[model samples]
Target: MAEIVNLRQARKQKARDEKLRVAEQNRALHGRSKAERQRDRLIADKAEKFVASHRLDPSGKDEQ
Candidate 1:
C-alpha cells in the first residue's frame, strides 16, 4: 500500500523553507552592529594612513 501525501502542505513547507534560507542570507549580508561598522571603518582608515606614510614621492624632494 502507498502512503497518502498532501500536496498543499508540501508546497507550503517548501515555500517556508525557501523564505528561511533567504532570510538567513539577508542576515549575513546586513547583520553588523553599529560598533562593528565603526570599528571596521577605523581599521581601514588606519591602514590607509600607514600606507600613505610609507609611500615615496615621485619628485626628488622628500617630505617627512
Candidate 2:
C-alpha cells in the first residue's frame, strides 16, 4: 500500500528547500572579506594573462 502525502505541505517544503539552497549559495559568494576577494581577483587576472601570453595567433603573421 502506498502512503498518502499532503500536497500543500510537500509544496511548502519544496519551496523552503529551494530558498535554503539559494541562501547557502549567496553566503558562499558574499561571505569573503575584501582582501580575500581582491587576492582571488589578482590570481585570476594573473592566470588569464599567463594563458594569453602563451596562446598562438591564428594568422601566419606574428602580431607585434
Candidate 3:
C-alpha cells in the first residue's frame, strides 16, 4: 500500500515555504545592522561638516 497526502495541506505548506524564501531573499538584499547604519550616518555627517567648513561666503563678510 502507498501513503496518501492531503492536497489542501500540501498546498498550504508549499505557500508558506515560498513566502519564507522570498522573505529571506528580501532580508539579504535590504537588511542592515544597527552598527552599520550608525557608521554610515556618522560618515555622512562628517562629510557634510567638511564641505560646510570649506565653503566660501558670497558676501565676503562674517555675519553675527
List where candidate 3 sits over 4 angstroms from the true fold. 58-64
How much lDDT does candidate 1 score?
Answer: 0.90
Per-residue CA lDDT of model 2 for 1-64, tens digit only, reads 9999999999999999999999999998888889998999999999988877777863446867
User: Which candidate, 2 or 3, would have the higher TM-score against the true structure?
Assistant: 3
Off by over 4 Å in 1: 1-10, 58-64
Task: Encode model 1's per-residue lDDT on 1-64: one tens digit a residue.
Answer: 9989899999999999999999999999999999999999999999988877777864546777
Candidate 1 at 11: error in angstroms?
A: 2.6
Error of 1 at 20 (Å): 1.1
Q: Over all chains combined, what TM-score does candidate 1 have?
A: 0.55
lDDT of 3: 0.92
Highest-scoring model, lDDT: 3
lDDT of candidate 1 at residue 58, scale 0 to 100? 45
Instruction: Order the numbered candidates by lDDT, best leading.
Output: 3, 1, 2
The order of the candidates by TM-score, greatest first, is: 3, 1, 2
Worst lDDT window (10 residues) for model 1?
Answer: 52-61
